[model samples]
Target: MRALSPPVGLPMLAESDLVRQVARRLSDAIVQGRLAPGAKVAEAAVARELGISRAPVREAARLLESQGLLRACPRRGFFVRALSAADVDELYDLRLCVERHAAVAASRRLTAEARAALRRQLGLMRELAHRDDPARIVEADYQFHRLICETAGNSRLLRLFDGLASELRLVIGLIGRLYDDPHEIARTHEPVLEAIEAGRPERIVAHVDHHIGVAWREVARLARTLSPTPGGAA
Candidate 1:
């Protein structure tokens, strides 16, 4: 995937809170291949480049390390994790399984407020997603699915899903690469949300299954082109 430049019109914050901001910037760089797999990350140089102290850079690397997006080697420094087709498939499949059940359960408890909120998400996603920018499309896609999981109303599952977001992103980003049609994605979403709001559990499940299967196929199709082997890289 190409480098995901910070979105236009993003709010600017100061450097006082450097750790998380540093981590986020570096994480975006890794995800977008500004920092490619196995590329060495130097804490001092990163700090120098960003005009900050090394403490935050080290902290950022440690954060990424915990997320499995970075690793340290003997006598070497941090490096981006290698992208893998198998890893993406397994993560996406697991997400599909969790979300399908959540959708069905959420349908049984649908409320007016939840329906309105979901409808808002679908609309916002449709608006931003139509742009040619993959980053915006992918960001909207995340909000859309996360909205579903929230409507599902399982606190534990929501936390679990949040924890797995980075892995979730691998396939979601791949989906944007696979298909250029945002209207298609947005159009298909209405029926799915409609079924959920109508309290049709069976239809909700089928809708969930359909969406996941379609998204999965797109990810699988592009992941193959990513080349499974990083070959001596991270």
Candidate 2:
């Protein structure tokens, strides 16, 4: 099992604040592959390392479990969630449904500020792709989608998208190696922005569907590679 690193010098904040901070740090570590999937997340170990109490660490693990980033078992505590092909399919399907609606809503009336924000995110994504940091690239990619969700102006829709943030970052982390060319990553997102700029809802939806469809395929491939071999029963 990979070791869970404590956040540097945690402040003596409120219980909820401590839990949230611990959750965020743990989530980032998991997304960055610092915490391997299926590895046990011992609250005692984490709490000890952070110089905090186990209560907050336990609460943080529960929060991560709710985000689909961790799994909790009876008497087994928490472990990083091991994703499967089916999980990938389901996630992408949900994203397709939500994002298609968001794209349409965003395209209905692309305000000047929204357009500028979208363009800025796109440019940042392109720039980040050129860098050697996969995490930054993934974040920039997320920003692009988030910009569209914000433009949609539907609070519920935005919340739905926000809820998927952790899983999406984990997926990108898992498949970062599959993206051999950073420029290609940037290129895949270009059509979505162009469609939005065209102010065509159907076109935007089509572009989003295609983008997510490609990602689904990549995730499926990774899943198959990670699956157990035949006759290798547990």
Candidate 3:
């Protein structure tokens, strides 16, 4: 199977590491739309809800702020940052560059075991899609793409792709209901897998670029629709 880059220099932080645990939970809430775009995030409220002190919660907010998932206002509390259409376009463009390289490289170097693992991820995605759980489906979709990066055998490429995971989750959360069939989501990925399995680098690159391009357009459309007009209600 394709190997993930072993996390480097990460000191052991057990589950009891309250700050990180709190941060992860908050991040999940944001990525799953439990916290909506522009919704105020109060440190005290979150701390009260989670049965913790405010310090860790405040630290967690700062962590998310660094990731562009939260924004701090001067007088008000932190809020979920609204990703604009331009933001979506930039994210997709960067993703396209990284994934195209990974797909093309994986086509040339993918092993049989890695192919099997990739197929397994795709199967999991199909199952998640059928269950109609957007959060799980989005995660599965990310895992499948991550496997492709792993198959590329480039540690730097995998690291770059991993960096985008949080923002990608934000995009998926924004889109909400991805497709009517949901199965269509799983099925659409097949051609990419097929191309990679065929060991055709050009085919893999073309398919990846096209796939991401379509997703970019859809997100951009949704962003424009949701964006407030000059005189419109936000």
Q: What TM-scores do the predictions have?
A: 0.79, 0.84, 0.86
**Model with the higher TM-score, candidate 1 or 2:** 2
Off by over 4 Å in 2: 1-13, 227-234
Against the reference, the lDDT scores of all candidates come to 0.73, 0.82, 0.81
Clashing pairs in 3: none
Which candidate has the top score in TM-score? 3
lDDT tens per residue, model 1, 1-234:
898987544233343357788988887776655775567788998999999889889888888888877777667777776656676677777887888877887787678887788888888777776555566666677777787788788988888788888756645665655555766667777878887877777788888888888877766666556542233154
Count: clashes, candidate 3:
0
RMSD of each candidate relative to the true structure: 8.9, 7.6, 7.3
Q: Is candidate 1 or candidate 3 better by lDDT?
A: 3
66-169 per-residue lDDT for model 2 (tens digits): 98888887776788887878888888899889999998899886898898998888888778777767778777878788889999999999999999998988
Best by lDDT: 2
* Model 1, global lDDT: 0.73
